[model samples]
Target chain A: MTERASFREYHQNIIERVATRLEESLPAQWQIPSSLREAMLYSLMAGGKRMRPLLVMAACEALDGNADAALDAACAVEMVHTYSLIHDDLPAMDNDDYRRGKLTNHKVFGEAAAILAGDALLTHAFYLVARLSQVHGVPAEQVVNITMDLAELAGPKGMVGGQAADMEGEQGLTELSQLEYIHLHKTSDLITFSLLAGGRIAGADEQKLEALRTFGQKLGLAFQIQDDILDIVGDEAKLGKKTQSDMKQEKVTYPYFIGLEASRGEVERLTAEAKSAVIEAGLADPSRLLEIADYLMNRDH
Target chain B: MTERASFREYHQNIIERVATRLEESLPAQWQIPSSLREAMLYSLMAGGKRMRPLLVMAACEALDGNADAALDAACAVEMVHTYSLIHDDLPAMDNDDYRRGKLTNHKVFGEAAAILAGDALLTHAFYLVARLSQVHGVPAEQVVNITMDLAELAGPKGMVGGQAADMEGEQGLTELSQLEYIHLHKTSDLITFSLLAGGRIAGADEQKLEALRTFGQKLGLAFQIQDDILDIVGDEAKLGKKTQSDMKQEKVTYPYFIGLEASRGEVERLTAEAKSAVIEAGLADPSRLLEIADYLMNRDH
Candidate 1:
């Protein structure tokens, strides 16, 4: 009956809804070749926090937009995020054996399948948006803008560019600005896009959109810094994969540039900034956005 | 001038124009990491026939649409084609060492950069389409539809799905229908999309659109079968990569399922069908499309 508990319930409900919708929306396995379908589904359905989709839905709700309208966009963002994870875990990239407490996609379905699956998902993201326009009767014009935004934020100037920076930076000493660039594009760009996409779908005004963008940027940075802290000091079982792997690979991280204590402080600062942006922007029932940021900052994994 | 000679000149002009535009449009190397940009440009700008972009431009022109309106789309299709080649040549895929008379992208840029470069190109394809909508003042709605069509044809339902089937089929004796499926999707989907995308941009009517689709499918199949024939009988210097490698890998091909002469016959049959479809559909100047089919059928490489 408490207000905070009700918001918590609302967040959890959206997470479950997103998970189910993602499963439902994917191309039917029998229609495509079984192996390819399985590969895409395996990585996609593998249990994760569903944080990106949750962000999408929350932003949609905050703008008093139809949650149903936001569903496909939420799933689309998740697909993009999941595809990135699959590619980033490939032997040629991070070469990780596990992800989200399960065998990495390439480990489960050969590297070729994994790569193709990632391609399929990335491609499907656009297709789904098109389907959204058709099925939901959203203006084709709005969908075009949404599609462009997603592509721009996830392309060279955004996530892919960041990924390239991260891969190249693996060999060099980590600089703060360089690390920021990597994190901003590789991690935060997609996350920021997810929130903005949700807001856009909901018809948020420019001022509200600006607030969502600011919240997304700060929260994404905070979330990534928390990931860095987890890599250094968190329990292995809770984290799913091995700890100290960033150190093992000599990958750049917040902990590498700043001490553990300072990194933790930065997360707190970013989380606070994210919350204030939501409040300043006067989002309806700001509780959910604020709660999500707090949860991201404090998550153990 | 003879019809063949004039057609050859037309094709040559488009190729040169496409190459210049592709080079001019790509993200400058300095803006992104040099290695990643270099790897992408290596495969992308490397000499090929510029077939996909040429198809797009020709389709647009046939519809009496402004050629300038189709340039970004033409470049976008080529980028997609180039990215597929880059990933397909990786150690995990076809494992080819040379492409278009040059060392493969991975050979020059290392596996990580090649993979990342492929990713960037794929992501950038959409970005370019979005930019097309913005820069050319194309209707956002049309662009969304175009984006969807491209994504659908190139996603699991089309190219990526075909690739998965191809990869999975590497272990088994390839069936005839299975081979057709692979060809239709893996090789033809993008080609089909390219032609259709150009037509769509040109405001082609439904009848013309259907004609373009049929023409694309037949021509794509014919083109791929020619590749199979060339792999068996092509001179290595002309083909740019080692010939007869399909047999070495035990990969299935048109030549593998049908006799060499029969495969050649099929190419002729498909080319005739492609040309007739264009003519029957009442396109303006179907000569260019008809001629392109003949060129594909006869090309040594």
Candidate 2:
């Protein structure tokens, strides 16, 4: 099979496995109050690309860590990612009703359930990480490091910082630096974590991690720009979310502030940079990452 | 010193010690983004009653773990508690201006920073626990168990669940069950965690942990009722937060659903229950806990 098709299958398979593992790992404590449980499950179980976990698994595999051991880290990242999405959609935040082709968590579960679900997912992410960190095979300290990396990335000054800036910027933002700040933390930090974590779990050294970080940073920026382009040129029906949210919110996007053609060129440049970073990581198999990068460059959703 | 006076001293001293030590253990990455660092520092430095951290110390002491070693756990719990407060005060949430007689984090730092600060605190909580579990002197697995306890308590199924219920209930709550859920998760979970984590760190046997849990549960319930009473009966200026938040939101509280006399009576009952549970745990210095229970029964804020 071609690299692109193989990458897609690898990505899909890992995500599915992580999702399955996550459901199985949830204990009775998670089952408390059915409505709350439903909310947590709804958002997490709602299908998406599961890109974060894929990065984790792929990175781990590349570095030589057992994929099974990395499963918790993989799932944890997704859980954190899902939790952020649920909260970001809250009335106080982005306030959306649809994501990934389904009614948002709040729409189906009510605001309370949605909030509880988000909280659950966030907490569960840690629980899974802690459990995996001490699994019989992996050294406990290393697992701790991986989980800590995730906690930091998903937290303030990283993904959350980006979010707050993104929201606040909508009111009155003109500077490029502020906009860059938003995307770097908000958009790219988690993706960077995804790649680093995958490599770290698999035992990638600092040199490899640095290369992957470069790759991720470029991919994330390009991915976001493409997001901007999609909002303008892509179909909302397929996107499953409001196509015009950025415009409606008056938020800064590459296309809105920097011009569409320039944004497209940036994406192209970023993709190329990302490809180089992957190749430089010196993995025997850069085929998967190369394909994934190209697909991100070309994807509609 | 009187029993109440002594525990107050105990709570104050250890919380400060834990807080100081925790500052040193903070993730190095926090220093990267100046804006993010400033926001986190602003709220964290504001400080509070330090009730959660105290519980961790107390629990650890009770279970035979050195309170000093468990200091990080105490700090972690407090961070989680503080973060919840930050988010709880957003414009779409309670929209409060002060906490502990100071400007609330969001009010002082703006909504964006407030959100990031809260997220940072939550994320930092786990990072601290993960680090704590790996401390040089402690048994790694024991530390692991305590960290796990901390994780579940801070997470969705626990404290976050309660917050979600509170937010949803604010719009127009109809049932007492909903109020109970909110109190249990939002008001009590962390407190219970605090007490339980302290004990867990000390390697408290299941029986001892159960006793501490029972004490924390009653204490937590009483604490929420006390908050209800304070909202209705305490001076606004003294409370630091808007006294009328629950009332303005039209949500049920101990005062709203039950009369003042009943709420007062419940507080006394729960405090006594908490005292008895701690007594059952058989502290070598049971005096400290006895002091806290008395204070919980009668505190004004």
Candidate 3:
């Protein structure tokens, strides 16, 4: 219980730090048109668990690197994630009315404004990274490499490709291999990138980088399977969303093909694999990463 | 007559080169899902004037920089331009049926695919810039600066801000200042970035950079005003689109406030100012830039 409490505190610390940075990163309202600023700030400040930024900060901390150096990147990843969520929830996409228990960007701002807000956020993410590279005095080579990794990972071959596949899959039958591809690219890719980016920023050596990459990939898969399980079993009120949405959407998920028990087992196995990779890499204080993995595997929401 | 024909030939050469490079810059079909790739390539390769890329090349050439070095940047700019066009033509935005005489992206592909394509292209543009920085062994610092410039110019404070203003202006009374703000940001900002990016790649002196900046602003305004004029008077077949779109949409345009003759006069004055800025910068062979400006001023299609 004590360990769990401490882990929660640690997670809270990272989240708070990231939240402050995010608020600071946005331009002043006076600097931009009121409506655009409001729309952008609306979704930006809507506040999720901020998992991506936490990964960045944690990765930096694990490597004994400067957490400050990772702040812009941390905020940048969150912006990208937020923008993806906005677009994904558009009338043309998932068409969700609520996200994080609040109205989606388009629900309040209208379709055009929502789309522009997403674009602004995405474009602003890179801008923030570039600006921070200068402000933090990080090497441009490192920043550019990081930027490339981000763009490629989030691009057509990565997240966008997965999304396109998912959309196409909806109109037809989906295979397990296809579902895995979708999971890997759509969700796992960005998660892996978040961790990899953190490790990269910390100047982790190649072996360490490889270990983080492996850990991230395993953890991401495990996380998604847990989500699949949650969709089936999670409390609607607690989760702040409808349960079994995938079933309603006819979206293929892990539990749909494999049994619920088997999906849970898969999550356990993947979580163990992630922890082992972290230990094998000999990351400084793997405790936090392990705790996060455990928390993800056990998370009800 | 001979000089005019040769100048036309020179512009055509740049346009052709840019078009080819734009094709090559996209990820191969194998790299991404065919549907996503097709959607992205469909708009990217859609034949247009390739003005932004040409500006990058011309600016680089004027500074005696290696054109090859700017090729990636040139292609990058076009990707940005294409992505903007895709989003701008969305039903939520302009709702245009045709662009470059072909069906808009959303018309051919579904809205979801179109949105994803634009997102993918925007992400891919940065990816290309990062890759080019490595492939060409350019200094990371320079690339980071360039990236920063691109992001800011295209992001909220620049292009996105302009778009937001344009959308907001549609609902309320628009003042001349508001219209200028929209035009400067929505259209001129990216154009300026293209030229400035070229100059930066060539390591131009501050004076030269300023000159390019000034030239770009003037040229962009002239180009937009000319577009306004064309929308009023251009032949449908030659323009490859229906004219009077601004009037139909009730978009605030230069010819709407200023008389048609005055708008034409503004284009002429701005074109001359652009040319003079180029010459004053002592750029080598200002002929192409001047010719481009004149072409923009005189173009009916």
Candidate 4:
């Protein structure tokens, strides 16, 4: 198969596996309250691009590691991602009524259930990571390291810190540096974490891991800039939400800071930089990673 | 010194150490946004009884383990506890304006900041546990175990599950069994986790760990019962919040179903049972655990 066709097949396969695992992630034995479980599953199963989990698996496979070993971590990252979305959509936060084209968690389940669901998803993410050692026989030391890294990336100085800065910026932040800082933590940190975590699970050396970090940083910026571009000129039906939300919220964006054409150029530049990083990493296979980068650059939604 | 006086001294000493550690927990190097940092520290350092951290240390000491070894885990449990309180007091949840006689997190920092602060705190708890292996040289296997246990107890099936049930119960839950389920998961689970985690840190064997679990469950129930009694009869000045607020909210407390005298009796019964379990555990010293049981049984706030 051609590289694009192979990448598509692999992506489809992983998405199916991830969806199944996520459905079964919260075991019945856990006896999570029925309503709470529903709320968590509602948003979790609503389905996004599953980009983070895919990154984890692709990174692991590129290292010649068994992709199955990274499955739990893949699900874990997605859970964290979903929880953030749910909380961000809360009335007190984004106050959005829709996400991924459906009613937001709070809109469907009420604010209280939505909050608990988000909290549960975040807490459960760690539980899944801890299970890596017990279930997959990944080394305890590696599991601990991943746990620590996940917390740092997702915690205050990482994603949470980025989010906090983003909210503060809503009060009229103008500096390009400030905007970059917000995106770096809020958006890019978690993306970097997915790559690094997958590499760690595969026992990649520091050099390879650093390469993955660089790749993730570049790709994340490109991905986010594309999002901004889409918000301004993309089809609303394809994007699955209202367009011009950034303008409505009076939120700053790359397209706003630099014009749309300049923003698009930045995406290409970053994606090219990201592809080079993976190529330098000298993985057993880098075709998939390279293709994913290219695909992200061209996607409309 | 008499047992009471020495117990008092030990309690005071641990509280001081815990307070200092919590103050320094979020290192300056993390570069957390100033406002988010302030919001997290506001709730974390506001100080309650520090009961959870004390339980961790006391359990470790009782096992003849170095209490110092359990210090990080101690701080971790408190962080989780504090985060829960912050989220629970949000406008969509209990709508409380005050916690521990201070303005609630959302009240002081706005709903968005409060939500993000709580998320950061919860994520950071796992970070602390993972640090146990790196910082204190706790065995990686042991750290992994503690991480799993903490997540389970604090996640959907444990504390979060309890909180969800409690919120659901607010719509006229009358069953005594439902109340017990809420208390068991919400309050008792974390208490049990604190003891078990401390035991694991001290390298307690399974039998001893089981005893700690039993001790914790009983103590946790007794503690919640006392909280119920105090809500109706507590001195607001000492309690640091309004008395009878539970009644005003129409919350289903132990006394609400069993009457004040019966609830008091249950606390005594549970405390006695808890003390017996610790005695049976054959620890290096059970004096502190026994004293704590008594303290909980008699505390007015």
Q: Tell me, by lDDT, which candidate is best.
A: 4
- Which whole-number lDDT from 0 to 100 does residue A210 have in model 2? 89
Assess every candidate by TM-score: 0.96, 0.83, 0.96, 0.98
Mind giving the per-residue lDDT tens digits that candidate 2 earns over A163-248?
86676677777887777777887778888888887787677778888888898788888888899899988887778776777788
Best by TM-score: 4
> What clash pairs does model 2 have?
A59-A198, A60-A198, A119-B156, A120-B156, B56-B198, B59-B198, B59-B199, B60-B198, B60-B199, B65-B202
Off by over 4 Å in 1: A1-5, B1-5, B27-31
Please estimate how well model 4 matches the true structure, expressed as its whole-model Cα lDDT: 0.91
For B164-263, candidate 1 gives per-residue lDDT tens digits of 8899888875479999999999999999999898888888888999999999999999999999999989999988788888898888888878889999
* Winner on DockQ (3 vs 4): 4
Interface RMSD of each: 1.7, 3.1, 1.3, 0.6
Give the range where candidate 3 chain B is weakest over 10 consecutive residues by summed lDDT.
B1-10
Pick out the ten consecutive residues of candidate 4 chain B with the lowest summed lDDT. Answer: B1-10
- lDDT tens per residue, model 3, B73-117: 988988888889999999989888999899999999989999999
Candidate 4 lDDT by residue in tens digits, A119-168: 99999999999999999988999999999989999999999999999999
Ranking by DockQ: 4, 3, 1, 2
> In candidate 3, residue A75 scores what lDDT?
90
> Per-residue lDDT of A1-301 in model 1, one digit per residue for the tens?
3544665677677778887888887656535788988888898888788888888888988888777878899889889999999999999988889887889999988888988899889989988877767787777767877787788778777888888888888788546998888888888888898888788878878899899989988888899899999998999998888899888877778987889999999999999988999899977766678878988987888
CAPRI rating of model 2 = acceptable
Q: After superposition, how far is residue B52 of candidate 4 from its true place, in Å?
A: 0.2
- For model 1, how big is the iRMS in angstroms? 1.7
Error of 2 at A36 (Å): 3.0
Task: Put down candidate 3 lDDT per residue, A72-107, tens digits, no spaces.
Answer: 888998888889999999999999999888999999
Worst 10 residues of 1 chain A by lDDT: A1-10
